[model samples]
Target: MKLKVIGIIAILLVVVGASCQSDDQIEFKRYYSGGSLVYQQHCQNCHGDKGQGLSALIPPLTDSIYLKNNKRKLACFIKNGLKGKITVAGRSFDDQMQPDDIAPLEIAKVLTYVTNSFGNNMGTVTLQQVQDDLNNCQ
Candidate 1:
């Protein structure tokens, strides 16, 4: 009877633990989910649904060699936007992505989604990180 009671208590603990989530986790979840919509609306046009750019016109986000190499400066790149010539996947794109195309919150969401999607799994970009990037934009 004691063994059965312990097992039941363990199960209850598991259930309760599963239900409990920290506030940061909830916010991250919200950011990640909202970022998907922002990407579809704002970015799907140039970047494509799967992040495959239009043949040298835009850069693909699906398998970002750039992101892989330049993770630190990525948020700034997003906030301040990109110009000049960039090479990705052995192809070159010479275009300017407008700065502040989306609001800062949406930028965080979009970056989080992109980093965690399309053959990339870097990590999440917090609102604080985005704000910091904005401060240090180039």
Candidate 2:
């Protein structure tokens, strides 16, 4: 009887662990999965499907150390665009980001996707954080 009880407890623990994982997966899908679509529509054309960036003209956003330090600037830069010069991975990109005017929520989604993908693990970019960042920019 004791052996049977131990087996039942082990099965229960497995089921509970699986349930917790599903919840995390749902949250991951809500942000990263949705953000991917936003990225494809707005950023993929220039930044490449994998954020590899175009040569001479555009700079890659993937695994960007500049981005890690200036996370707040991303939303503003993405929306209002970046002109002049910027450095990433020791390379200089002197060009235009071309102001996109994407919505605040879209910016958050894009940032979340960019900062979390492409060898980046900057974590989720919340809507409120984007709004605050944009407000501070101006």
Candidate 3:
């Protein structure tokens, strides 16, 4: 009886531990899922359903290097819009991206989704980070 009880407790512990997600993981999932919705509503029109931006017009989101290098500026770009010339995927794009007047939290969520989707793996772009970046926007 004692051995059986110990085994049951061990099994329960394993199950519980396995099912538990770290705070970061939980937050990532929340942001990613919420961002998905935000993307569909706001970004899908220009960026496309697969993030493959319009040819030579809108820059695609699949450029991991650009995303990583400009990770901090992304929040500002989203909130304030982008214009002029920029290079993505070794191609130069001179176009205008209208500003999205979304809340900082929504920016964070959508950024989290964009940075992690379309062959990107930039992890989570937290709300705090987005707010900080927005404050420093040029």
Candidate 4:
């Protein structure tokens, strides 16, 4: 009976732990999972499946510093598109990234994915943040 009780307690602990994710964690997971689909559909073509980018043409998403520094501008870049030259991962890319015209929520989701995946950890890019950034696009 002692072994049975121990097993029951263990199962309860496991179930409780599994369901203990915080609200922010839940939000992040939702954004991350949705972003994964968005990335595969919209971004994977040019950025590559692993975000490694094309050789010397497109910029890789592996650069965490670039992502953090350009966090605010990313929404603009995505909504309005990007052109001209920019250095990423110690290399120059002058390729043009055409506008996606996706919604603000999708932008938030994709940004959250990119900034968290591929060696980055910038945390959730909330929809409100994306909307604010979009409003200030240059």
Q: How do the residues 54-89 of candidate 3 rate in per-residue lDDT, one tens digit apiece?
A: 999999999999998998899989888999999999
Q: Which candidate is the best by TM-score?
A: 4
lDDT of 2 at 76: 90
Once fitted onto the true fold, the runs of candidate 3 whose alpha carbons sit more than 4 angstroms away are 1-18
Residue 77, candidate 1: Cα error in Å is 3.0
Clashes of 2: 0
Worst 10 residues of 3 by lDDT: 18-27
Report lDDT per candidate.
0.83, 0.85, 0.93, 0.95
lDDT of 3 at 78: 89
Q: Per-prediction TM-score, please?
A: 0.78, 0.82, 0.88, 0.96
Per-residue lDDT value at 44 in model 3: 96
Where does candidate 4 stray beyond 4 Å?
none
lDDT of 4 at 52: 99
Clashing pairs in 1: none
Q: 94-127, model 1: which lDDT tens digit per residue?
A: 8998765667788889988998888888667887
In candidate 4, residue 2 scores what lDDT? 100
- Write model 2 residue lDDT over 1-138, tens digit each, in one string: 999999999999999887777654666658788899999998999999988999878888775578888898889998888988888867889988889998898888888889988888887788889999999985
lDDT of 4 by residue, 35-55 (tens): 999999999999999999999
